[model samples]
Target chain A: MDTATVKKIAKYLHLAELEKREVPRITLQYPELSVEEAYEIQEHLVQIKLEHGHNIVGPKMGLTSQAKMKQMGVDEPIYGYVFDHMVKSGQEISLSDYIHPKVEAEIAFILGKDLEGTNVTIHQVLDATEYITPALEIIDSRYENFNFTLPDVIADNASSSGVLFGTLLQPPHKLELDLIGVTLLINGHTRDLGAGAAVLGHPAKSVAMLANMLGRRGLKLKAGQVILTGGITGAIQFEAKDTVSAKFAGIGSVDFVVKE
Target chain B: MHDLISEKAARFSAHLEQAELMGQGVEPLTSLDPQITIKEAYEVQLATIQKKLDTGRRVVGKKIGLTSIAMQKLLGVDQPDYGHLLDDMVVGNGETISFSRLLQPKVEGEIAFVLKRDLIGPNVSALDVILATDFVLPALEIVDSRVKDWQIKLQDTIADNASSGLFVLGGKPVKPTDIDLTQIGMVLYRNGEIMNTGVGAAALGNPAACVAWLANKLFEFGIILRAGEVILSGALSAAVNAEPGDHFSARLAHLGEVSVHFNPV
Candidate 1:
């Protein structure tokens, strides 16, 4: 994609998020959008967010689950950023901030040191992790009806929106990363459930892939940054006044309520 | 009631401090006073630590004891107890320590957190600990009970500063976020032979959580874990007895190794 087209799409998606309005997929207009071009658009969108005074919290992964990967027809996952403004916990989530949001359970890694290099392994990722905790990611695709192609989703920052972290912080070494069981509850009822293995066998693997991907662009995961390892369970749509919670075995639980 | 508590705390503190100064293990505080509460035990500990501070010994850090679930269960306690670390108690890595100075010393491998920010809490979370930590290092805590024969109950040990003795910190410092602390494997060697092996999870599932627990628990006592303090999370495995001429070294994966030698009598 040309610089002009990428900027146009980036501005369009930024407007979609800021204005709480949904638009058609970017691929619908630029069917030939390559993954690299999509990432370029994402970078531009991140730049726009920075210009608007939003600081980057860290990166997040998308389509890490086997089911999601299979459905998306991809062998790997996509990466995006989480802004500091998107972090919300211990407070009600106002629905006015989103167009149509869905919530999913996740394991978020907080780094103690910098993770860099193209050959970053899962072990390295684990080594760099200070701790892990249960997290709830609120994904609101700027694309209409949450429908989008791979490039379209990537360009939209993998629907990065809001994140709520659990109180429990555990060392990754102490956890059986692939076996952590999670239950997603909506309005006090179990809506969906999954395990940490859903995220590319182990959530750390998603982080490793993300680090290696960013390494290609000379970027790195910094210490004290929170990396949301993608959703473990399927995303469930939520609306105003709905209470959503995600409970992770041994890790603890995180919950939030939506308010209009 | 407050005066009685303070009186008992002062008496027990003097008793334990005398034993420490004389290099002799004394009777357990609980044995002397069966009615001693955990709260009172901590008061005794603070009193003794205050004595050390009066003598110009600075507070260096803190140590959490009985972090493992099994150890907690064995002691019939749901949580770990803490002790103060004095500046004089630090042994340099690879340095030889005098055996005659310690009574009934036992060594355990641990991860030490070096904080860069104050962790004041009633609600300090594990993430707060990680953020406040400047780095993590491999550590060897040489625990010694002022109580005779190490026959200590939870209160007894807590009153004796959780059996605080000497600690040796490794040189290689890594950020807490850089490695999976729960998975860090430890191989404790005594005189070049493996004595025990364990993982970071052995310390209350994750050592960082142990620190978090300590910070929150300390809030009740009006204590804040200040920056620059070295907080020993807890032992990762069973502590091995340290005898005269014994050389103990702990090899912690990723964090590196720390060792201390006991001088021959």
Candidate 2:
């Protein structure tokens, strides 16, 4: 939990991701990793990405589902950033570029106005949202076999790796935010299907919670930032020659092919 | 040639209207005329609806049917069909409806979109439907078939006005932007017991997509969905048979609940 320890763990996780290899869970070594400390480590890890010239595209939420929260024994969702280098679209993803990648379908929101405050309401989140679109997140956890404690995953940037977005964007006020349906397909077959309510009842609520969480640190979501709400469907593992596509009802589809 | 088509449409419409008025099921129009195309069916539907409008009843909105894959497969159709919602078809929530007024009634739970602006579309998208929507409400549609034994092909159902009957709307109105329409869960209770359950995605993926499809389909007929019209997107689940004395309630997540009671004969 000390500054030096946080930096060390941050570097360790960063190197694991960079080397495309899995490492032991951080909590396995520390045994007493606090959530606050885990986030501190995450900050340092993001700082490392920044130092490496990666731009912060926006933050993403993890464990936003009630089932996931209960499984993780957490009362709230976790946050991590998506770096500019991690934002991908319309491109083939090399399997060697990640440790072990899994894909999940999500709804992404682009903010039109700044949202700041501890009491940010879901309405405020909706009001500030400029566009909503379908998103596909490729999460590659650096922990061994994708296994990690909540703190371990938190410090690993919520297992954030890469994101691809659909081009279809509609204003938040023009959509039924909670009802957007998504079907995750791999190689043209349905793998998983879910709706926007999978993300904390409503996708907007996830953004609201994120905003309030950031507000605690005197941070705010600025205009034009893309926020990937948590996955609506469970993440499915993919391999070389697999094509992952997310089809969102009323929105559009986002897809990419995995290559060796 | 057009006159012959109009003549046939008028005759079929009158026959269907007569069956509806007498609360008696009639033979399918497709059985009467196997050559009846979807367009001709729509003309028949409009002719029948126009009769009601002439009788002082008003056009309340529109309804899309056969949206779910289950329903589409059941009807041997690959796409959805639609109908007009007349003012006379509005049933008050919780109101007991006389059994004599309905013939072979079946119930379906759906989300109703109340438009805030006119949607005249030759190219309406789901986003257009959402932006035009003011709010959405939970609804129960009592679908009755004029075609005997519920035997219907796409054309037969279209000619029968997509089996439009009576509908009850929930009181709670949530803004379209405020809720997720695709994932809203619905529980249909018949006689105080759960009969069916579904989510908004059952209707053409998202219910709003149903509305969008309806708007564009209507454009071919030169019909525009106007502001203040309540559009019943589509059924969230397969229709359940409605028996006399049955009390049916549909509880939609975030949108609230709507119910109707059939009068004991």
DockQ of each: 0.02, 0.06
TM-score of chain B of 2: 0.96
Candidate 2 lDDT for residue A132: 88
Candidate of highest TM-score:
2
Best by DockQ: 2
Q: List native contact recovery per candidate, as a fraction of 1.
A: 0.00, 0.06
lDDT of 1 by residue, B156-264 (tens): 9999999999999985999988877765656677998666555676677678999999999889988899999999999987889999999999877667789999999
lDDT of each: 0.88, 0.87
Give per-residue lDDT, candidate 1, residue B247. Answer: 95
**Please, what are the lDDT tens digits per residue for candidate 2 over residues B1-265?**
1223488889999888778677788888988898889999988988887777778999899999999877787878888989999888999989999988888999998999999999988888988988999999999999999888888889988989899999999859999888678767666778876555567777887899999999888888778899999999999767999998999998777788899999989
DockQ of prediction 1: 0.02
Candidate 2 per-residue C-alpha lDDT over A148-233 given as tens digits, one digit per residue, 9 for 90 to 100? 88889999999999998888989888766665556777897666665666688778999999999999988899998999999887
